[model samples]
Target: MRTSHKMDPVSLTGLGLGVISLTFQLFSGCLKAYNLLADARGMPAQFQYLRIRVRTEQHRLGNWALVANLTEQSGSLSTSLQLNEALVQEVLREQETILTSFWKVSHPHTLMIDDPKPGPVSGTEGEADLQERVPQSKSSLEDRALRFVEKMRRYPSRIRWSTFDRERLETSISQLSALNDAMMSLLDSQQQYKFHQAQIRTSMQVLHLNKKVDHLLQLFQANSMQLSMAQFSQNLRLLHSMQLSAYSSEPQEERQTLATLARFKALNVEINLDSDDERSNTSTGIFEQPPLDPRSCTIFSSVPSSYSPEEVRSDGIYENIPVWIEWKYYEPVLHIGHVDPHTQVRISRLSALLSNPQKPTQFHTPSCIGYFNDVSNYRFGLVFRRPIDVSSVGVPSSLFDLIISNEKPSLSMRVHLAHTLATAVQYLHSTDWLHKAFRSQNVVFFTNPGDTDISTPYLCGFGLSRPAQNTEMTEQPDSIPLYNLYRHPLAHSSIAVDGKSGFKKAFDVYSLGIVLLELALWMPLYRVLGVDDRNLQRSLQPGVTKKVRELLLRESRYLEMVKASAGDVFADVIRACVEGFGEEGESLHDKVVVRLETISI
Candidate 1:
């Protein structure tokens, strides 16, 4: 697929009467010798290095062919290379002779004739004759070479390379390498430089593709293993169902119905006929929160807190307080974080949009009553109406608290939490907003004062949340390293160095990636990095985000832990989020929500 440009042709003349034709014949001989070695089978592992050497030499020869313009249709190179013909011809002949040695070592039973006929001419007819004989001469040489290769192919496969042939093969390669060097030396400096540059570019491209292939292979192998285990379990359940059908004392109809259900379940299918019914929908409503339209939501500004000052409980849950706004009294939980001292206007607008009571009920997040300013502390709080599902619990605990307490959720619970958080993010992005402060601490579970519900994770910590359309607003990086641990490196600066340097959707995805990592490893950010809070807090400087990013990227242990705890599929999703979904074709819903749904305990 690579394109080549025309270059000055080397002159090959006065060395002999028919050296040009002889050089072409020798090139054909080299091609034949390369094929003979390449097609050989039953080569021992000890001499596999020889096979690699053959390939390298073949590539070099091909480059030489391209540089010399020998493969071009115009044949301009052949006409110009009439000066110093004998020296070039001798170098080609020597390379051909060395390559032939490989054939003799591998296929001793086959006989080959080394004969070439080069037609020489004088004066004006010489150039025309050279061009005319180019095709005929090449064909004659190729035919003889193919016949020799065909004979060698017919030899028995039982014969193979041995220790004795090692020295001969290496020596042949070295001699051809020397002759190749000689041939390249005759070319102009520009041609050699261009050839080497092309070779380097080719190598780097091949390396990049090879890494992609290797990663795909690892994914394939991991999936294959999981599929095999799943299939085995399904088979066992099917067998059990068959036994029950054969021996059960129940009625035939009932037994047949049970067997059919078993069969469907074995194939991972649900047979729920009333899946669209209200009852079925309500049962699954907690995970299917509808997305709210920001345009439809009302923004309330300067709604002061109606209650006395209340600090966060020791359990890290805000006390439920009465928030009286717009002539309505509603009791909502306060999820608050510190904000920039100057951005009161932006915070007020975002809270008003989220807390609009007319907005649809958000199951994965609390409905917002309105924004309440804590003037005493200069902190703004987002007042969210208690979720119906969590109404029975006293207060909710953050994921950070649960993780440090060592409350390890079951694999199924963790999977559900991951799915819910991913969906929450997708919904937020789809609704034209960004949860810029997304992290484990922001994710809360509504449960008893001392207990945690890992299954239902609500995304919180929206103090920094903003609309995606508002690109004019700049982001201030969090002072605490713990908060910035989940943020993208590009978003660590308040100053937008470029379009990507500012906070974007990918930054939100990066935060989601880190939260998923917490779910995967069941550890807080500090513990995952094997550091304490004091040490993490000490890293309050420029480029801290990049430093942490580099640490995570370089640490294979985190990925290993994810795979061990959550399996291959979950690890892959985490990788995509952390690294980012490469192209914009797939929405976060497809890349995260849909992929997480496919994963089972």
Candidate 2:
């Protein structure tokens, strides 16, 4: 061996050449142009539009043409060797330009201002009016809640030991206890505050819901709507089983199977759906908890008269489900920069009922059909349906995870989402009302994606829909506590008075576009990473919730990514949010007002 080394220079040179060739031969990933191949397929046509999401980083062969096989409803991906990463970036940049024109969302930390309180509602006629308006407590929303809670409680031991892990059960109980305690204390304080409020006015048009507290119980109890802890736990199970099984993102291959969450602090689905397609129910059990009613319940009672709805719902009280309209509602108290401590912010449920013209109630004795709010009494906060799902379901767990599977979603499904969302929004707009709070959860199955009327999209969380007439909606400061990254940006400023500072059809369009982007992108397109619910809530913590603002407004790396991925359509929209000001330094909050003015819609 030593003798051969002395004269092997030529051999060594050959070895070097071989090494160089191998390095140069590294295979580049094959990328073909994204095409709507599903438009022509034998499948039952699950969707209509042809949306596709191709990772710019992975698809470098920009020269390749998109070839579609309609019969297969898919494109056979192929590509010419692409050595230039720059060309791929360029292609992505071009696409971003298109996205910019359509999408715009508010920064999470953006400070929102609730306006001054609207006066009040008065008169015996108001009381009678309220009675005539409320629904027949027909849906028995509260009754359902109570029944659901009770049912879950019955099988506590079976449920608790049945789950894959029993540790979460103990922890969840602690959290639920904390939540219950906090809510009870808050309610007590709010009632005391409201009693003082009724004194300020004698003759008014609306009433605070606080005045008619018993009526709320009537609704909750009507059909045993209120759920016991265990039963509520069971309802959680129902929600899990009924969770939607579809994807609406940009990529054609990003379908994830997260768990369905039911707790108030959080909700998430954690299951291995990598190969399972049959879609069956997955249930987790919980231990039992005792049944408890509000003998200790206390709230505001300044009303001199009774609301008609309350009397009706309270009719034959013992026979009804002792539920609490335990529903949470909010109203924007917009008076931004007013410096007046007495008028800074507020939380008012009365205003919520008033805004919805469909509500049958009129001003009642203590509580009214219409409402007036005060900042000092109610805190400005959103009452979510459930707690935060901190199981961390939003992020991908691994590369081989279900998100990037061969069974990825299709374009037609994407298009159907757009069309359906549009149809739903059009309906709300037609009613002269806007869904100030828009998000994925807010939008749900309208006749089960399989249905065709496509007429009415069942929108939940109406609890947060506020009256934006003269009010401007401002989300909490810098936190995406109970939201997916995709929905953070749709939180923006809106108004009601044709021109008195309001959001117009365009804002709605922007929200829809972001939603479209969400469906197309699969994962949240513009996430304020590292700022999730656990460490990023306004009230939950002090410095943890740093408001991971969207870069569409700020010129950061995120903004670049937004431009690169969203293209020009939504890119332009990002520019607007980026500027953070109107054409002449006007507040962007007011920009929505101006935008509404210029558009016919």
Candidate 3:
């Protein structure tokens, strides 16, 4: 197919003055061209892949434009683009050239322009106005894009695409893809710069706010404020009494009993606490699910006697952690046990959700089949949809067993393991539940241990998990060095700065870091430090402080091994986790989980 040897100089003026605007204009033009090609009719079914590919490129370009803030008329991207003006401008010009090659026009005069669309025309007005309009308004960009698309489509006859045209189209697509890649790389650099600047500004703002608060407090104290602690307490008590009085003021028939009032007061406290916790926590609301009624749920009173429960034991830690057992029932014929359609529907949906979770790409979690309650205990049974014989080979059910067995997952699987595990923890934290027992032992697989898909790990061991806003007393610290190895240093004492005794999300993050460290090196924590349980115990005798310091040192030293195993990026992610996800008010969701998702390996 004959194509334009040179881009119309008039059309070139459609690219705006700034590099980002110009790049966006060119991208919009390409996206429009791809959409037209993709949506073209009468194409043979054999060439459907080409259409799919063109549509994919169209989507990619469109998404990139949105992400790069190209849709905004006055965006920060314009200012950011100034930093790399020459390179960006060159890329834009190249894109502009490649964009014109989509059509078979050898000359700019091949197509007649009638009522040229009105859009943002950059540069000189006289000759430039004759050029195509670029998108100034978001809608205008799309409109102008369609105009280019229609212009390309208006040939002598409907363009019958053949195998001959495929090569040229593919070439143009590839060139456009390459140019877009370059533009995205530049965009990433700009984004990183902006993010860094934002972080610095946030830090400065926090500092300033802290100083202002401190100054205000000092001034109030110096002025001998009448609102003393005792007076404030008295006033607060008075308000509380007044509120109770108001409640009591209701008609005798309308007023609630003391029991109801007390219950309401307790609920109010919980509501206030939850709200405060949610407001203070950055990780909340990442994952939300509708609550299901326990009464309506399909509860199994009995499980298969043939299927024995598995235990995963960490080598250094002799404690045998009971694996969350799973088994599925196959009854093609309806049992007709219950008549409630809504309950059945809920069960069916639950089964479907468990079997086919709407999970992120390359991320997996073991599906919980249903809840089973024995006389004394209630537990969730997790299952893999496909039945695999675990009995054929003695397979370990958890990461702890897998690691101890000296069988290493492939590099890709290891990377995925780290990522999915981190993500699972993030989701857990996001729901305001802290996985107090997060470790390799808790990271289980539904499949057998011998050849388990490490990529699809499920975070278990929720027996110790608790809500972030819960005021329950923290469990006593386990003196076992094996368990302490996974615990954060502060967690060893079960004391926080606020004098609260509980595992925070930060503690869980530290545990995750240890698990990640073990994954990277393909060794347990005790082995990494060249110390067995006995050695660790002896080291712990000289105060938990010294032992914690040793652990920190080991973590730092083994970081090189992590880098050697997985690249510097993975190592940095590990470091961030171990260091409490950085001092900047960042959460594991932002620092560790999202960062892991970005790692290519």
Clashes of each: 7, 121, 2
The per-prediction CA RMSD against the true structure, in angstroms, equals 24.9, 30.2, 24.0
lDDT of 3 at 66: 48
Model 3 clash pairs are 395-449, 396-449
For residue 147, what is the lDDT in candidate 2?
41
Residue-level lDDT of model 2, residues 1-601, one tens digit each, is: 0010011223334533221111111111011111111011121211110111111111111211111000111122112113322232232332322221111123232111221223221222122233331211222322332343232222111100111222232223222222222211222333323322221110010111211222222222221222347744643443233231222121111111000001100100111111236222322211111222222222222221121111111101111321111222233446752223322222233233222233211111011122222234342212112112222211111111122222334544444444455444433432223455454434532122222322223343333333333243333322334332323333422223223554444444445545544443433433334343334334323222223334333436544554454443333433443333321212222232223222221
Provide the TM-score for each candidate, comma-separated.
0.43, 0.26, 0.43
For residues 15-104, write the lDDT of model 1, one tens digit per residue: 222223344544555666665554344344344435544544555565666566553122334343445455555556556555554435
The best candidate by lDDT is: 1
Candidate 2 whole-model C-alpha lDDT, 0 to 1 = 0.26
In model 1, the Cα lDDT at residue 382 comes to 55
Ranking according to TM-score, highest score first = 1, 3, 2
Which has the higher TM-score value, candidate number 2 or candidate number 3? Answer: 3
